[model samples]
Target chain A: MPYYRCVVPKDSVPYEQRAAVAKAFTDIHCGNTGAPRSFVHVVFDEADDRWATPYFLDGGNRAGRSEEVKAELLSDLMGAFREITGVAEEDFSGRITEGPAKWTMEGGMVLPEPGEETEEWYSHGQAAAGG
Target chain B: MSRVSFNCTMQEGQIGEELRAELAAALQQITQDVLGESPDDVPVTFSDIPSGYGFRGGEPSTTSLVRGSIVGGVTQEVREDFMRRICDSWMEISGCTVDELVVSARDV
Candidate 1:
C-alpha cells in the first residue's frame, strides 16, 4: 500500500510546491514503509475549491501558514523528516522485513509494482488543414 | 551477517550487473590493497526498474534502488568507501543526478 494519502488544495498552491510537499510527507512515512525513499508513493489530492480548505486539519487547515512561506517550510520539513527517519528516497527497496508476515503481518517494505508505464507521448499534434 | 551495500542512482555509467561485477572486483582489489589476502567470497545484488524515468545519460533523476552484499568482516568506513567508488563510477557512466545514498547492517 501507499505510505499515506494526502489531501491538499490544488489551486491554493503551485505544482512544484505540491510535489515538494509530497516528497517531504513521504520521507516522514518512509520509516514506516521500510522501503527507503524511492518506492514511497506520494499520491496527490486536489482539494475542492468549494470547501476552500484541505481536510488534513480543521478550520481552514491552512497548515497554519501562508502559501508563500509553505513552500520553504515544506522543503525544510522534508529535510527534517529525512534526518529523523534516516530514510533515503532511492533506497525504498532496502526495507527490512520479517519472514512470512509473522507478528501482526508487518509490512511497508518490498514494494512490488504491477505493470509498467506504457505511454510516454512527448507532445500532441493538431490536425492538418482540410482533408 | 556482514554486507557491502551500493546504490546505482543519479548519474550512472554502469547498471547493477556492472556494479555487482565491479563491486566484486573492487572488493578484491580493496582487500589486496589494504588486507594481505583476498580471504573469501562476497555477496552482492543489483536492482533494475524500468518504471522510473532515467536521465539522458541513463542515470535516473526521479529515483531508484540497488543493493549488493559482501562477505567478510569489513569495517564501516571501508564499506562506505567502496560504495562511494561505485557511485562515482556510475555517475561517470550514466550521468544521473543522485538524490542520496544509505547503508544498513543486515544480519543474514
Candidate 2:
C-alpha cells in the first residue's frame, strides 16, 4: 500500500532523473515492508523560494561563524544541493521566514513521526548552544 | 568527543535516545498509514544523533535526490492537526519548538 510520489515542479527536475529516484525509493523500501509498489508514492516538491544550506557557526573547538565564514561553510552544501538535486539557483527562505536553515528538512513542508529521529535531532539540537 | 553537529539548539531531555530509534519506524508508519503501503513501500528513512555535539539525523542528502511522501498531500488543517498531535507528544520527550517547523508536500 506504499505510494511514493514526488512533489517537484517540471522545471526543477528532468523526467529521467525524477523517475530514477522514485524507482530507487521503491526498490529500497518495497517488499521489505511487504507493501506493493503501487501503494508507495515518493514526492519531490521543486521549490524556487529556498535551497538547502549548511552554515558553520563560531565555536572554539567547533566550526566558525560570520557571514563570510557561513558562506564558506555553505559552499559545499550549495554545490551538493545543485549536483544531487539539479537545482539551478540557491536561496534560503530564512529571511522570507527568519533565520537561515541548516537544511530544508527542518524548515520545509515535511512530516515524519513525532518520536522519529528527526525529532530527536531537533530536541538534541535545541539543547546545544548557538542553535 | 565533539564530532557531531546539529541544525538547531535543543534541551537535553527534549528529544531522547529512545525516540531517536523509534523515528524511522514513525516515519515509515506515517507514510504507510497515508499511502496504505507496507513499511517497505515507504522510502524515507529516519536517523538520529546523540550527545550535545549538535545536529540530528545523519549527513545532508543531495537535492538531486527525490524524497517525500503522500501523507503530505492531506488538507492544510488536517496536516496541521497531525503535526500538532505529534508536537504535543514530542514536547514531552524533547524540547522541540512549535515554530520553525516544516511539512513537505510536493505534487507527483
Candidate 3:
C-alpha cells in the first residue's frame, strides 16, 4: 500500500493539477514497483503547515523494497509533481516512510511483501477495478 | 496508557455526524474485542479531507483510511483479524464498499 499525501498551501493546487499529479504518481509508482494501480492512493491536504516548503509530498508505502527503488520512486514522484504543477524545486520536498506489509490490510486481505505478491492479490485488485 | 489508538480520515461530507459516532463506537468495540483493550481507554479520532482534495487512481477518491497503533505487537493472525473486523464493521456502518476502505493495525 502506497499512500501519497500532497501537503500544499491552501488552495495552491487547483483540481486539474492535482488530478494530473495523482495520475502521474500512480503511473510512476506502478511502473517502478509492479504494484497494483488500485493500491495507490493520492490525497491533497491543505491543513498541514509544518513543512519548511509550501509544497510537500508525504508518502507511505509498504516496507521491504530496495533503497534504490525507494529513492528513484521518490525522485520520479517529485519530478512529476513539479512538471505538472510548475512548482519550483525549492518549493517542494518529500519523503516516503515504510511500514511492514503484514501490518496493513487493503481490500480485506493482508498485504504481501514487495516481491512476494501472489495471483490472489492481483485478481483482487483487478476485481476492485471492475476489470 | 491506552493499548490502542485509531486515526481515521475520510472525505468531507461523506459520513454524517451520526454515522461517525457509530463508526467510532464500532472501532472501540473492535479494539476491546480483538485486542482486549478497554473501549473507554481507546482513543479514536476522525478527520476529513475536503472534497476535491482526495484522489484514488487519479480520480476523485471515495476511500477512507483507518490507521490503528498497537502498543505491543501482535501476531500476524491477530493483526489480520483486527483489520478484517474493522473493514467489515466500517463498511457495514458507513455503507461503503470494501474497495473504499483501507485498514491498518500497526504495532508500535
For TM-score, the strongest prediction is 3
Best by DockQ: 3
TM-score of each: 0.32, 0.29, 0.97
Q: Lowest summed lDDT over 10 consecutive residues: which window, candidate 2 chain B?
A: B56-65
Worst 10 residues of 3 chain B by lDDT: B71-80
Judge candidate 1 at residue A46 and give its lDDT: 49
Residue B101 accuracy (lDDT) in model 1: 27
Candidate 3 docks with a DockQ of: 0.85
Q: Write the per-residue lDDT of candidate 2 for residues A20-67, one digit (tens) a residue.
A: 544554444332332223323334343332234321111110111245
DockQ of each model vs. true complex: 0.02, 0.07, 0.85
RMSD of 1: 18.0
lDDT of 1 by residue, A30-129 (tens): 3332333343433333445233223231111111233444444344444543443344544221111121111000011121222211122001000100
Q: Write the residue-wise lDDT of candidate 3 on A1-131 in tens digits.
A: 79999998988899999989989999999999998888889998887569888999999999999999999999999999999999999999999999999888888888999899999999998787663
Q: Which rank order by TM-score, best down to worst?
A: 3, 1, 2
Candidate 2: residue A97 Cα off by (Å):
13
Task: List lDDT for all candidates, in order.
Answer: 0.34, 0.34, 0.90
Stretches off by above 4 angstroms in model 2 are: A1-131, B1-17, B47-68, B71-74, B92-102, B106-108
